[model samples]
Target: MNGLHLIAELHDCKCAPRLLRSVDALRELCLTICAAPGLTPVGQVFHQFGSAKAPAGATGAVILAESHLAVHTWPELNAVTLDLYVCNFSQDNSVAARSACARLIDAFIPERVEQREIVRGSCPK
Candidate 1:
């Protein structure tokens, strides 16, 4: 796998307890992740839908040089879904992606987490 894409399903998150209801928090997180070394954010957008009182959640994506990072949060459930994708490009950016991802996960401090890594691009058959 030359490139790496990480997906994490966070359960019972604590860092952004109220962030699930605030699109602001979600956007901030995305921006922070994109600021990591080797990442270049091209564009970003956030969405809020659901109950007016409680707020459904926040969903958005940040386009990066290697690829992109997206996040979705559910305040009511104290759960969040996160994705970090970085291509090897000229060199290996996988380590950078993982380091950046660790920061995001640290922020959530989820009680339970389901994470996976997928290899992208072509290498050896």
Candidate 2:
């Protein structure tokens, strides 16, 4: 399947503390972004990590009909990494993928961003 994949590395995010450490908050943000781009959400899973000796962080993934969106946050470092992939099997979903990525970036309010786009599963003519 032909698809567009976006990967982003965020540094120095200034979002609220809860957003960076809470699994529920991250999950909600992912779901909202998915809806904003009209991506179908089949299911989702989010996990929180850290202990008293360490700083808390979160990891989440939303399973979409077209593909999936995944995110990981490091509160101690004020950093985040995001991945969004959409298969264009039936139609072009590049726009939707970009929109979702933009929404995520807006929410994080990162001071520095490193993003890349990759075209996957292309067939030779």
TM-score of 1: 0.88
Q: How close is candidate 2 to the true structure, as a TM-score?
A: 0.93
At residue 80, what lDDT does model 1 achieve?
88
Q: For every model shown, what is its TM-score relative to the native structure?
A: 0.88, 0.93
Provide the clashing-pair count of each candidate structure: 0, 0
Q: Per-residue lDDT for 1-125 in model 1, tens only? A: 46899999999998746677778887887787668665889888788867657688889988887788988988778898999888886878888899888888878888999999999878634
> Which residue pairs in candidate 1 collide?
none
Candidate 1 Cα errors over 4 Å, as ranges: 51-53
Candidate models: Cα lDDT each: 0.83, 0.93
